[model samples]
Target: MLTINCPWCGPRDETEFGFGGEAHRTRPADPSALSDAEWAEFLFMRTNPKGLHRERWVHSHGCRRWFNVERHTVTNEITRVYQMGSASEAAETAPAAEQAPATAAIEKQGSRS
Candidate 1:
């Protein structure tokens, strides 16, 4: 099972979270002006990079809040977890010891205070 680090609630089981989507996606500034193909591209296109991919996740059963995770797709190791709009450079470079504790499942539902 994947151990996802929740920015607000700490490390919890992957079952407690919901995968939002690929991170850093830009929305069309003028959606109404776009053609069907443009809209489709925006909706369907996503980066499937093999390493160091960033993605959004929500702590559903714990904090019920959303955050971003910089994870390695090949190893399924989460390198960093941060808030939605914060800078991630520091977390990305920090050693594993400096990163969030990436184990220990949620003891119970709604356990976070």
Candidate 2:
């Protein structure tokens, strides 16, 4: 049983979260520009780093926000977690899973009251 620590919602069962592959990786803006191999690489290849790897995780049950997480691949231990930001953030830097869009939406709703 894998458990993930959601920065906003605390630690929860792994079933509540979705593994989003490597963090800081984005789909090509123009798929047409990519060659067959490049497209395949994007879709299939991934760097399963042994240590201090960044990954994306979605909190399906709690905040419903897609965020990033820092984990150890070999040991299956999570070191850090934060929220995924805008598209640009995904490109430049993969922020942790504390500030996802869903949480932002929830925060907005709370502010309205």
Candidate 3:
């Protein structure tokens, strides 16, 4: 019953979207050069962190566009939503204090609902 705000289509029901797994995963430049174990790791290995997690989500029932969502794993609070290939990726490595603005925005949005 979460409300996900699509970067292009605004807020919509979570049911309208499809989870696209962990975000920011870089595929190998030459897949054929990888060993079996290396390829397997690339396909199956993903971080399962307990706190903030970056993920990809597609608005399947709406615009059908994909975007990134920074969510809290335990609380399911979505802290930020941005279009693919944006500069927001830099925020991933930013200090926690630098991320306060995004978190505040989410908190404000939640208060409205």
Top model number, lDDT: 3
Clashing pairs in 3: none
Enumerate residue pairs that collide in model 1. Answer: none
Model 2 per-residue lDDT tens digits across residues 12-85? 89999887788776789999999999999998998876688877889898878776777787888876665566
lDDT to native, each model: 0.71, 0.68, 0.74
Q: Could you tell me which 10 consecutive residues in candidate 3 have the lowest summed lDDT?
A: 104-113
Clashing pairs in 2: 81-97, 82-96, 82-97, 82-98, 83-96, 83-97, 83-98
| Model 3 lDDT, full chain set | 0.74
- lDDT tens per residue, model 1, 13-54: 999999998987889999999999999989998889999887
List TM-scores for all candidates, in order: 0.72, 0.67, 0.74
TM-score result, candidate 2:
0.67
Better of 2 and 3 by lDDT: 3
Ranked by TM-score from best down, the candidates are 3, 1, 2
TM-score of 3: 0.74
Clashes of each: 0, 7, 0
